[model samples]
Target chain A: MRTRHPFTLLTLAAALPTLAWLLPAPAGALGTAAVAFGLAAAAGVRRVLVPAVVTAAPFWLFLFVLHDLPTTLAIGLRITTMVAGFVWLAAVLAPDRLVEAMVARGWSVTVAYVFAATLSAVPLFRARARRIVEAQRCRGLSPRGSVAKRLRALRALALPLLLSALHEVDERALALETRGLRSGARRTPLAPPPDPALERAARWALLLVCIAALVGRLV
Target chain B: MNPLTLEGVEFHYPATEAPALRDVSLAVAAGEIVALVGKVGAGASTLLLVAADLAPRITGGRLTGTVRRRARSGIVLPTPWTQLSGMAFTVWDEVAFGPANLGWPGREIARHVERALERLEIAALAERDPATLSGGEVQRVILAGILAMDPDVVLLDEPTAELDPAGARALWRLVRVLAGEGKAIVVATSDLDAVPAVADRVAWLEQGAVRAMGAPDLLAEEATCEAGLGTTVAGVWRAAGLAAPYPLTVADAIQRWR
Candidate 1:
């Protein structure tokens, strides 16, 4: 499962959610959710399954609080399928592999770079945000107070990260330039993840399953 | 063409009144390693950025100078973590990032990446995740990333700030090896003791300008000592009132004592 091509894994993950939303609620949602969980299991259940369930649990709680049980169950299950599927995908699909597959398949290098860079920026920003929080805490910035105080603390925690991240744009641009990422410059993929025939077939099969489900529901 | 040349160069960061660099003029030849030393906010890092052609071009600053650079340049900035291409999973891929972006052939990229990893003594870490590396390891990885590009000139801003003593020594050796390979290298650092053994020339920066530039022994001069740019050995010698021309390094100090 870990060796499956990133695109193939992505396609399966997306198709599951699409089918869950398009098909009838209750029964259809339950089946799609099962498939999503199965995929999560394949992506290392210890890492993926727990996260998917925990992340989707809040949505279910909110839905139930805002509406009746029947409506909540239907909408909550659909959202769970979508959320779990993406969590599984994120667990298995390495951004670098996806970028390599894109570049190898004749996609624009800049497009691949943008895709990978934006995806990776989340973790970088998260790490920096954590550091800023710790630094502020050490400086006697009380995080628990009135609304205004909390807001001020939030500003303190967020302001430096914002300014430094913005300043990092110039540094990133310089780093990119030195790496020869000029306009129209083609990039060479070293150790591009192999896209075997089986993975391609699996990707097509996932798309077909989604299409078939949609057609059956319409008919 | 000379590897690097800067003539009457002055720079001001956008939205700032005072310039970050003033009347800076210097040149670096192939096979030379020049070190920039100064107090905090002395613009040593800024000077290296300008040398790497990253100052006004990427930093958005006003510059007036006749700058000439003959060969390609790469810079490893102060913070290695910020410079990391976070997408890379392994140390090998991190090192290969620069060459891969250059569109070199796969074999060529692999060759350069492998050599760079070996050069930085990170070959054992080739398969390790870069995110898990320690501060010293990250600095070495960043150096490998820049070196893998095979640029003709390399600029490093405090490359060893995060390294341990042993790691610092290894880095200085790598710098000498790079210069020996005929690649012009410019480094801005606060490591005074290592400069004499590694840097061929030292530029003492003060207030965004080159106050003095001369041999590695320039760090032993009285004026440089007054600015707190002197080597530890020189400072100790002068404090003891031992001699007029103080030693630049411990080896020279030992010779003088003998």
Candidate 2:
């Protein structure tokens, strides 16, 4: 009985629909940015918040000009909750643990692996992008250039990042194979997360609550 | 038993007219270290891939001849970032990726992973995020990951390509230690100066074929110079009007200076 970061993911998932229902349309955008920041923070990726906020600024401004304050706030809250939920899960739930959980719950290992790989791809891409940016900087590419020049520098980053990623896909496939990620085999998990009775009860309760809320809203 | 034997192997990549490697034959005895050196794209990487059973198996290409590995092989490719276990948050988990995949017991995985981190001098960074490490640190972490698997035959493609001088020295020291512990190691690298001390033998790959192979002295030969595949030290020594018995490393040069 292995429970994997039950509190974090459960709390986040429970908060999503509530935020969605309570937030107004215009504020929804701001709420989303807040969520993104919150989630990033929860994921121990507080560094991403500055960038995320900057990126979402234009959208926030647009909403502010077009919508009422309550609507904008509601929407903002919704977004923040959703992002926070996902970020929390990403931070506390190891991809391997998630994969094991899915497999233990009768999902195919292939499906579990795909889900796990998708989850891991984000950090991988981010790491690669940083390397490419550093390499470009070493080659005298200005990080603070004109819009077009910056775009060009970004393009340089993109090419190598994508090429390396594609190249690594092959290596990853081989690595996975060597690790016995083959189909039709009942693979033994190295260390399954604890499945505490209290966690199981909480998970089920959360699921039921979410379903009930959805049904009540529809009715 | 020889850990690896590549016999008359040839490989042609898809849509490429020239073969990436041709008629390359080499062997690595158990507990030996063999370093492969030449210019970039001279086929060193391809040779390692072939030895790791990844070239024809994973890369779409036409491969010929026999490539036999006597022991389980693990490869740490050139780009350390690409080799990262994305699912891992902490460096400790990243290094444990390969061993956990092999379904080792938790205790065993922990033991090997701790040993690997210690050997790579990254134990302090164990709880740190792998994605946030510097290039040299990331390279060490990748090496730690592979070494944790306890592969009897390890193949590294430009393992120290991203490392600084100190980091490179540390990796070479670990290479020697692994060999001492009876792991057959094949490393493809451009760091020829470190080869003489780290490698028991050297293989010169030219346009995907074995141009020459023997002791580290082979890299300092007139034949290597004629082939345009002489190492940096050898090239410098040759340009300095040095005669036979040329030095392959700074230590050798210092010794000869006296």
Candidate 3:
């Protein structure tokens, strides 16, 4: 599954949530949620499953607070399916493979680059945030104590992180440009993931299933 | 003919009154390495940016002068992490990123990428995640990435700043190797000691201007030493109140001593 083409993985991730939303709620959503969670589980229970559940759990609480039980159950399972599918995709998909696939498919170099950069930005910023925190601590900026002090510390940390991230955006743009990632430029895929005929058929089937489900729901 | 030439070039970043580079004129021919040495804010990096044709184009700056590049060019920016393509999972792909962007055939890309990896002595690290590498490793990876593009003109800004002494020496050797391949190389660096061995010519930049340009021995002169831009051996000799001509490297000092 992990070795599947990026488009195949993307289709599965997309189709799961689409089916959950279009199909009848409760039973339909529950089935999709189970499948999505199962896929996420394959990546790792501790890393992917635990985080997906932990992330989606808050929406359930919020739904329960705002709406009745049945409504909450209906929306909650659909949201869970979406979140789990996304979690699974993020874990199983290699960004470079996706980029290569896109470039091989004749997509604009700029579009492919933007997608890859957006995917890579999270961990990049997280690492920078950690460094900023360490630097602040070394400078005797305590991040502990009462609410006010912690908030003040948070402010100090957030400002530099935000500013530096903005500066990095410009630097990254220049770097990408120099690497020849210009708009309309064609790129050769060095290692485009192999997309089999069976996988392509499966993707089409998934798309058709979603369309069929949506039609059934509307009618 | 020189692959890169900048005659009477001046550049200003948007919204800045002080020009980042001022009336800079230089030409770099094939199989030659030119080193730019200066104090901080001395416009060496800006000179490199201009040489790569990235100053006014990508940097949103205004420029005026005759800047001509007869061949393709690539630049290795100062910070390795920031310069990453962010689209590569492995070091191999990271190095191949530039060549692929040039729309080269798969076999060609592989050949260049492999050669770059071998040249940088990172064949063993070809499969590792670039983000996991150390500063020096990433630095090498970045240089390899640019080298794989096989540009005729290579511009490097502080390429060895992150490297340990041994790694820095290896990079200087790589720069010389690149120059030997008929690539016109321009590097902005503070590693004056290495400059003597690697650079064919040295340009001493002072406040966005080329104050002096001459042979690598120019780094041994009193004016360069006075500005604290001289090589370590030269500075030491000057500090010791030695003779007029200061040796630029330890080897040069040893030869003098003998």
Q: What's the count of clashing pairs in each model shown? A: 0, 22, 0
lDDT assessment of candidate 3: 0.90
Which parts of model 1 have CA positions greater than 4 angstroms off? A42-73, A131-144, A201-219
Q: On residues A1-219, what C-alpha lDDT tens digit does candidate 3 reach at each position?
A: 789999999999999999998888899999999999999888999989999999999999999999999999999999999999999898998877788889889999888978887777788888889998899889998746899989988999999888988888777877787888877888898777899999999999999999999999999
lDDT by residue for model 2 (A1-219), tens: 113544436555555546466334545435544555666664455544444445445655776888987766665455555555554554565566666556555555567667767776876578768887788789998869699988887888798878877878877776665444566555435445567787667767766756675676577
Q: So what's the TM-score on candidate 3?
A: 0.91
In order, what is each prediction's RMSD in angstroms? Answer: 2.8, 6.2, 2.6
lDDT value, residue A148 of candidate 1? 92
Position A151, candidate 1: lDDT:
90
Per-residue lDDT of model 3, residues B1-258, tens digit only: 889999999999999999998999999989999999998999998888888878888888799999999999999989888988888889998898888888989999999999999999999999998889999999999889998988899999999999999989888988888888799999999888888889999999999999999999999999999999889999999999999699989999999999
- lDDT (Cα, tens digit) per residue for candidate 1, span B15-112: 99998999999999999999999999999988888888888887887999888999999999887776778657789988888888788899998899
Model 2 TM-score is 0.74
The most accurate candidate by lDDT is 3
Report lDDT per candidate.
0.86, 0.75, 0.90
* TM-scores for the candidates: 0.90, 0.74, 0.91
Better of 1 and 3 by DockQ: 3
Instruction: Give the worst 10-residue stretch by lDDT in candidate 1 chain A.
Output: A176-185
Residue pairs in clash, model 1:
none
Highest DockQ: give the candidate number: 3
Query: Comparing 2 and 3 by TM-score, which wins?
Result: 3
